[model samples]
Target chain A: MAIVSGHPTEKYVRIDRLPHIWCPGCGMGIIFNAFARAIDELGIDPKKIVVVSGIGCSGRASGYWAYDGFHTTHGRPIPFAMGLKLARPDLHVVVISGDGDLLAIGGNHFIHAARRNVDILVILVNNFNYGMTGGQVGPTTPEGTRTTTTPYGNYLESPFNVVWLAAASGAVYVARWTVYHVRNLTESIKTAMQMRGFRVIEVVSTCPTDFGRRNRLPDPLDNLRYLKEHAVYKKNPDPREADIIWGKKFVIGEFVKIEGKETFGDRIRRIIQIAQSRLRKSGSH
Target chain B: MTGEIKPGIYFWSGNDAIAEGAIFAGCRFFAGYPITPSNEVSERLSWRLPQVGGIFVQMEDEIASIAAIIGASWGGLKAMTATSGPGFSLMQENIGLAVMMEVPIVVANIQRGGPSTGLPTMIGMGDVQQARWGTHGPHEIIALSPSTIQEAFDLTIRAFNLAEKFRTPVILLADEGLSHLYERVVVPDPRDVIIVNRKMAKDPRNYLPYKADDDLVPPMAPVGEGFRIQTTGLTHDERGYPAINAEAQNRLIKRLIDKIRKRKHEIIDYEMYKCEDAEIVVVSYGSVARSAKSAVDMAREEKIKVGLLKLKTIWPFPDEVIFEMAKKVKKFIVAEVNEGQITREVERASRGQADVFWVGNYGGRWIYPEEILDKILEVR
Candidate 1:
């Protein structure tokens, strides 16, 4: 089996499943590599791992893994994963979804899951545009960016900051990382998985084919360079907005961290005890 | 009749009886939101479940409530949720998922007036059609209605049993009147009651979650098991992979519909009250059945031969029973809270043997027995 570099085991990957269903030079491949490396480092039992994905480019990641995988309906991966996790609390439930799938159609489930603080790991791959559906405008589409739906330049609508939204919605762990920072992204996923409650790792990846082609970065390499050079890191400085063609307000880092007192499972168990006691006392038993 | 009358048979609301029945059936998880008459069901469940080591969660909304129940069911618990018409509308998408994925769940819709939150506190059977075709796609549904509190307890147990046996979502269709009105309910011992669990694949390694066997029902392995099962809303093969071929699609669609259709004999349940040697048959379900029964009794006192065919399982409609009744009865009066929902089914089953008359009340009101009798008298 061909393994992604920096993994302890040579047997975990199903290399034959690739070349993956991703466009050439798509950063999702890089993100997938980072995810595999993170899983390897964790050394979780492959049999106990379930990967759930929704409809989008990132949704296909579940098919690439040899573990238990579910390629579910568009924007429904979270609830599907929640079902899996609730059924088998012993298993590790990890959800991988694109910005459109997680933030657009699935926005309601997203906040409720975060509020419940269910024990699941969520990885959001934001590529700014809906790449799988011919580069339509998405929830995270930047202001004044041209896309199929937002032609003649996008109206300057403030887009959702996923990390901030997750943090505010009571996610136990929230982090933001770009594809350029592969190491940081891998570490964030690992940490999110290790956390006991709701964990969200927001990965800002480049959509060279869709977002890039529309914004004059016709070459895939130039799109990658734009992400790497323009995305301002807290530790390092970058060029001013005048020099950058697109993604002028790029920022990435571990944004917020808050540990929950009790997981949803624990709370449910407690509620069951209370309900049972009440029934017995009322002679309804 | 038995010698000693059971005092445990004191008047109890249908919602309370259902909660007790669910407890007896070992339902450990309940996720629901309060909605008018159905709120009593959730309230009773909330207060009773914890005593037996069960979970009751008051969800932010009905959508989340059903979603949470689905999640809890996967956690290896008998789970349920309750709502009224408006709340039931919110649950259609997830309910469809449960049906398509073959998730064993029980949903109780104590119906009220609708189109949009019509009458919150009053009774209506407006959701009778919604119960059958509310969800998108070709699928099978098992819906039961109870006319009295005793039937509420009994049918709730049957609902869970059918859900587990068929590995499909089962709906307990009650109306506002039945949900809130109190009546004597005889609680049976759990030992005497039969409970069915979803069939588990004997060989975990060879398990195909959606593969139908001779019974046309597939064995299921819960999430914690080592078996890897994939569930999706898209048309899928026996292996649960999305299949687009016409043959695969036809086979899956047929299996989904036929699994319930072929098992109609096992699922069909109804009660015939004074139907023998009757000229008129009143076909009804839920609380409307009570009014129909009263009208039948009143008609019999007046020397009119009228019978009541009270439906227990509303879906996979008791066609065989209805067909048999239609063969003998001169006229069939189908009464309900909605305008001619089940009446249409009765007409089809009757096959032109009898004239089907509909008596319906839509604006959050129950169809009175006198009104039904008047309709019967007019037809006579």
Candidate 2:
């Protein structure tokens, strides 16, 4: 019966909208708190920050955050955030949603946004399965994992290692952490927020109701224990080597961080400047 | 005379006029995926928008294009996107989201043939019905059809103004024929054009994000404006909090529909020609109306009492005008490029008061004046 009320980062929480819909032992609350704490530590103006989320269990985070939050449609947060940032270059836009929402239906947008190096911080909460719906295997679901969609153990050969995909897609900054690594997750979020180009932080979290129960980890806390035991905390592991092979150790760290890169917005401004100059030369303006 | 004409009179295609109109309307953001016919709108804006200190993004797809425009709108920019039939279909669900969120955006669907990517470079008014009901739900939208390249410029500006005024998505439904049709378009001074911006909240604390005023449009506080506004696709109350109940749905949907529905008279624009004492009235829109006008003129020469009614705004139906015309005319010939989309609307409005005949071409071909003149002759 512990409430999210009076939490350290309570100012960022929407007290009116609670109690949240997250299950008793779900790790979304932890990740959500870490995000709030990150924002707090950075002392960023909430007014200048907008949180855009797509549909999922984690998509609900946008509703709980006391900021300019857009709880958008499924698989579309990245594009929505891109538009927001492009419109108001002064505003800090962030996309906080589930792994399935960002990687599956929204995958095209994800890579394109990365390729463009649009300025936005994306916090992907990976729960391995679709939690809002029944236990359904998702894009990040481990091979041989059991779910409602894959009852007799998943036959899918490989699950996407999001960190590698993001890096390969030209993300300026990419990182991965589990909900259990609170300090690491918080610090990563803070860094991503300040970064100018497309930044992604994938937080591997628990889905007790759907994913945890279907697997051997019936209790969500056990899932946390598994993450803590199985994760290898590294500073900058090779993105290609960051895959989670389930039962084997998974590397979690800031995989990529390229500084002094010109963002898509900056490049666009340059394009406009050049085009306007050309127009002036031709006396069209 | 060709070189000495007014500087405003530029030979521009319908699609080109749309882009110029958008810029004149203070549209500072254009995000779209390139599709035929409609692609020119985006291509023109790509360079034009940037020159005006605006942003143009070629998105991954139509859904992203619409999504980006909605985001740009919420970010306090006059935003728009252009697409053809297939792209328009891809944009339906997000368009619904834009409706529910009450985000102001202008989506120009330069319609081509379709059910599934039927014709990429041809004409189709098949999307006339889809323009209204494409997005799943009970929400109403403002969709406009323009006949001339000039109206394309004028109505595209009007579309932005109406979108800003009503805080709803406005569909500038054009066709492949009109999109590519090059004509002399008069671009007005930017100052002469009336541009409406989304009303912003005056006070931070008391500003109910969804609270409609006498005009039925709530003042929007753009994100990053210190309002800390929360907007969602889900049905919400005046405070913009998720309130999923019959009461909330009823109240929210009523305002969403009624804002445009009740103000239909002010929003609806159409042209009627020589309808007095006429036996047959040809109802048409977009490029088809041009042929319709020619047929009406030809019929008049033949002593056939025929008139023309060109619809500028498709949604909100202009029911009163059509019904009024129905009462006066013996029969109405509804001509379009599609089988019989808006014909049903004329029939429904006529309510059996007038005999309705459908003059439609499937796609690819424009409804020739000869065909309409023949229809008028047969009915006469």
Candidate 3:
């Protein structure tokens, strides 16, 4: 297997496809690197894992990973991963997509999957704007942030506090991290991998080419430093306080971790058992 | 439970028969959102699938439903989804994706009136054109239309078989009338039925996931089957690697089209009723075909020479059959529940060899035999 030097998880990546299409100083590579490290450290069989992604910059991560990967349509990786997880409960399905792909157009699928507690790990990379489509303002764009669509500053309402949204929508595990917080992000992924139910780890990533350049943070690292400065770690903060304000304040850390509730697969199996017994009693077959 | 299908005669609706047929064809995964005229398919499979050790999921919406089935098919299971007109419209983009990736999955569109939820409880062949041209792309599709409840059962199974055999998404286009109509259907034993699975790569070491054989269909290696497969809707090369060059694009698109087009003779299916010496051949499909067949019988009794040509496989158009009929017949009456959809195809096939008359309306009801007879009389 071809491996890139220095990265412990380089063996997990498709080195033949490198170098990746990510822009210079993009945060997607960092997040993907962290994911590879987490998966590598966990020592899970690569053949048992499936990586699914939708259309966006972050969606490219599925193609870069050396696994059974699917680059699906825009805004559909959650339900796509839902099918993979539901059909073969033995495989570990992970959805890695962008904010625009997961939250803006695919918001209904996101909340519903969380509500049903489908057993899958979702890593949502929020780059504040739609990076692939030339940085249009998106669902995660802060209240006053300027983008190609909101050139004169956004007059729209505040963006979603996804940590709170995921928690309120019944995600069994919820956490938030930044690209700069590599250790914390990797640790959160590792913990979520061992856990069950709908686990969501929102990574606040950067889009220097589109979001940062328009917002006057021309250097991509400046956006990373901004995230490092603003994010406050809270063990169980109110989801309402988890909003990301541009160049200002935000909240991070694991917010929700409630176990013992039945996952979608567990409930489905139980329903099937009950229905089968009912059929047997009725003697239909 | 894994391979045995209960063989018996039962009075069943088209939706129920389709669900049973899916089970008989080894569809282990069904993901769908309930839509009128097609909901019974999902409801029946919801229980049937579990008993057979399969999975049935009622998704949040139709878009998710199709997307999920594609994922499940990639996960090494034969998968299917059911929907009606509006839901089918929502599933178009993913249908195109399924086409692009050449995923072996079945999508049954029990069509109702549409242009957007026009009629929920009524029937229309309004989706005939949409079934072919709805998805935005340059690609060939196979859509099978069924008239009777029994054909519904058999054709649904054939849809799955054809999808796997051709490595493409096969569509079962049943309308609202046929979906709700009940009839006696004799389901064969699972051992008796012919089930075709995708050809898998024998040597995993040199498995090029998109490399085609002589028949233009590549052996499919499902994800997680140790082939470490990578599949995407984007233009890709034989190795399943994304390639953006003109040569790769031409190669991929050409194979996708040729794989089905070259096998049209095998994929195209239809029933010709008394068209050997008739002057008028009424072209129709779905429920309209039933009434057209009756009208043809009535015309024959009245000594007005007419016949019925019922289309079972609607999409690889069966233009050859139409052309043959056009040469033999003096006039062609295309009877459907939508305005000028199949009629346009009949006219195109006729090539001015015969006069073409269209008997269609958006009344959200099955066109009666009397109305079709009137069109036949007008054509005469």
Candidate 4:
């Protein structure tokens, strides 16, 4: 038998917690892989990385992650991450969770964290449905899609344009990529990590077990084929035109990047300086 | 003057004292939203926390406030948030999360009236029962009540210490009346004040963050440390990994509840005023204790042989004192600001050993000393 080298991203994974809870062709695995590869490639100390996850199938990614993991209550990861980042500016905090977990139940926190421009990275895996709880229709579920709640079809409400929301909420960096674009997603993770303030990378993911069977793409490979044929990689893609349409082409690329902006931490540091200086001048101990 | 006010007597409101007390207790992180009566706690911390090299943030709402404090607690900081009844209601789910994750955080609930904004500007002891059973599921909580303004400062520090000592969330259940009143609080010397920090896991490589020692508190590993600790709100194993089996659920929940229940004697606290040669013991807590004590004194002047049992710690319910007193005392007068909330508790703990009298009031008002005195005389 021939000897084989260990996996390149093995060091950034929790082998003990492995055989993750994600289903077959679940985009969480690929996203987790790309995240590990990005950290490994950038040579950032894994010890400084912290992963905060909310409830859902996608929330399980924190368990398999090698960094410090906090599996918080559903829709609470952003506020938790905000608290961690504000308390310890040295740590690199990242929120990894599903579309329903982030944009739906945690929607208010998502917007506010971006508005505050807190120093944290958010990886929102856009699977269009609540995968963990048997594929219920969620905030990002496209029109005409079938789900557990919407057995026939969903056409009542318009889906949120995530990139637009992020940009409007003052996110410093926002991007979108299908799970098929592995290299691009990896690069986006690296790019977002290097930036200060709130950075959001939406990975348009495939949920074959829940989302696929109800829609046309029943098989795991069918969802991948749909992505492979229809993904349109663009530069600064308009978020309005980037909404995912079932079996139709969707825009995927970096949509916004604003640099040289002051972060919540930077503003807080100035407050600390002024407060302490005033206290010293007053001779108050 | 953020870190520690010099050890001297200062006249301040209960809210102000609570804020200063948090600073004294080495609480470096504050996250909260503005709510009636409790707003001053967050407002002061916003100005003071940063001065002492700590961080203070006003989150979107009380849910986020509770979540943030819990998160910061895991990040190796003593954190707190103050809220009223409505806000406390919103924080219950994550409060349960703190209990599940075994994170140390302090929640100061300067309670106002409510079952949906019942009395925003008024006093309410309606939340005393809620404080104990607000969070869903089978678990135990630690709650402290302050009757005086000075005790607000003193107990806030004690709240943080107990939180860190047990690695569980502690509640400082102050009434709106006590929260807004101004009185003298003696800020302790910094060196003399004892601050307890969470016991950290000694070994990083073989760290089981959820595995408890003899004390039933698992040593905590700071976030972003090399320990790579897993903290979860789910029913988890000793490694903090989610375990769905009935065995894991039973083992984990049993230990979490037992950790506090087993140490009930150490955790329970109350004060007995002139109960030695008395036949009637007036039982009360929070601001209501003040009224109850005054009523007891009135009875004493009339030679009615009455005394007071003032609760300093509300949860783990000082049941032993009540149980013991039930044996000696001829009758029990349970004076509460709310509608007989703690009255039932007194009856249960007394085990029907004595005749129990209930002095109750609605959330919008207080149970006056005269009313309690009338009840004391009627029962006597």
lDDT of each: 0.80, 0.90, 0.88, 0.89
Instruction: After the best TM-score superposition of candidate 1, give how far the Cα of residue B300 lies from its true spot, in angstroms.
Output: 0.8
Q: lDDT of model 3 at residue A258? A: 83
**Lowest summed lDDT window (length 10), candidate 4 chain B:** B1-10
lDDT (0-100) at residue B232 of candidate 4?
88
Encode model 1's per-residue lDDT on B36-86: one tens digit a residue: 979888887776666656667776677767766776676568889999899
TM-score (C-alpha) between model 4 and the true structure: 0.98
Global Cα lDDT for candidate 2: 0.90
What TM-score goes with each of the models?
Answer: 0.91, 0.98, 0.97, 0.98
Please state the error at residue A236 of candidate 3 in Å: 3.1
User: Which 10 residues in a row give candidate 3 chain B its minimum summed lDDT?
Assistant: B1-10
Please give the ranking of all candidate structures by TM-score, highest first, separated by commas: 4, 2, 3, 1
Q: What lDDT, from 0 to 1, does candidate 1 have?
A: 0.80
Superposed on all Cα atoms, the candidates' RMSDs to the truth, in angstroms, are: 4.3, 2.4, 1.9, 1.7
Cα distance off (Å), candidate 4, residue B126: 0.7
Judged by DockQ cut-offs, the docking class of candidate 2 is: medium
Candidate 3 clash pair list: none
CA error at residue B120 for candidate 2, angstroms: 1.1
Stretches of candidate 2 exceeding 4 Å from the true structure: A1-6, B1-7
